[model samples]
Target: MPDTQLTVTLSGEGVGDARVVVRALEQAFGAPDELPSDEKATVHMATFTGEARAEGSPTAPGHLSAPVAVTVQGAPGAVRRASETLARAFTTRDEGAASGDQEQERQLLLEP
Candidate 1:
């Protein structure tokens, strides 16, 4: 099968919280193909190639308690897997009902 590329973007109050989310994503999808960098030092973005797996529960220790927004785009299966992984790490309520196309992309607002 062809590789599936997933892009995850995190934006929130503390960069540490974003970093924690990234670590969780890495555990699910393996190391990111493109790691986040400080372009302007506000938002964090990373990309991974492949379907995600739930290896284990990811924890954030010493991370700031703040709100986080995560966007994941990839194949439908990969997106679903990533969404499930993220839901475990952060408290998320569905932003809106997803349509068929929307299912391929997930947008989650997370709270600590």
Candidate 2:
């Protein structure tokens, strides 16, 4: 089991209702902390808030905005890399990218 926590910004049109948002988050996290989703992995998570962002010039009639945010959690050490482990998930450059130990050697558990 992995408890990897990470954060990234999501941009989309009409993110939808709270229920839909929670469902989306559960899908994103790959599991449910306090709800149900389609993911098979259990990565407990919670989103505090997602404030709408205003886009475009002030004079423009049509503008769009997406909520930017910070997420926190823990994941596999091999799959996560850095000089130091994250101190309570804050933010990441992006998701599904090799963010740790890009060149570390792999050894069998029973080797040593």
Candidate 3:
């Protein structure tokens, strides 16, 4: 199977909060292939490879009580699964539209 990549970008007040969001992503997608630069960075990023699954770990309230943007790129199936997991983890606001033709991609804007 082709490798799937999911990149989650979190913008919030503190980096600690961002880390919490990253941890939530880790719970959903397994250990990330890459993590954000430092704790001081405002906009943090976490990249995960392969399929994403819910680990049953609950994220803290304040962690996602901000604005977050997630992007999933991979096979159609993988992207759909990742998007679903993230949508559930983030909120039930809206189902983000999917784009890209050959290489599938989905962009989700989440708010807590």
User: Would you give me the overall lDDT of model 1?
Assistant: 0.72
Number of the top lDDT candidate: 1
Better candidate number, 1 or 2, judged by TM-score: 1
Q: Clash number for model 3? A: 0
- Against the reference, the lDDT scores of all candidates come to 0.72, 0.28, 0.62
Task: Kindly list the per-residue Cα lDDT of model 2 for residues 1-112, writing each as its tens digit.
Answer: 3333433222223333222333433323433344423244223234322222222222211222333222332343322321122211222233323324322221111000
- At residue 53, give the lDDT of candidate 2: 22
Q: Itemize residue pairs with steric clashes in candidate 3.
A: none
Each prediction's TM-score versus the true structure: 0.76, 0.24, 0.64
Error of 2 at 45 (Å): 5.8
Summarize candidate 1's per-residue lDDT along 1-112 as a digit string, tens digits: 4244777888887567777787777777888866665646678888887555646756643343788888887777777777877777667765642447534777888888
Looking at candidate 3, the ten consecutive residues that score lowest on lDDT are: 54-63
Q: Comparing 1 and 3 by lDDT, which wins?
A: 1
Sort order, TM-score high to low = 1, 3, 2
How much lDDT does candidate 3 score?
Answer: 0.62
lDDT over C-alpha atoms for residue 107 of model 1: 86
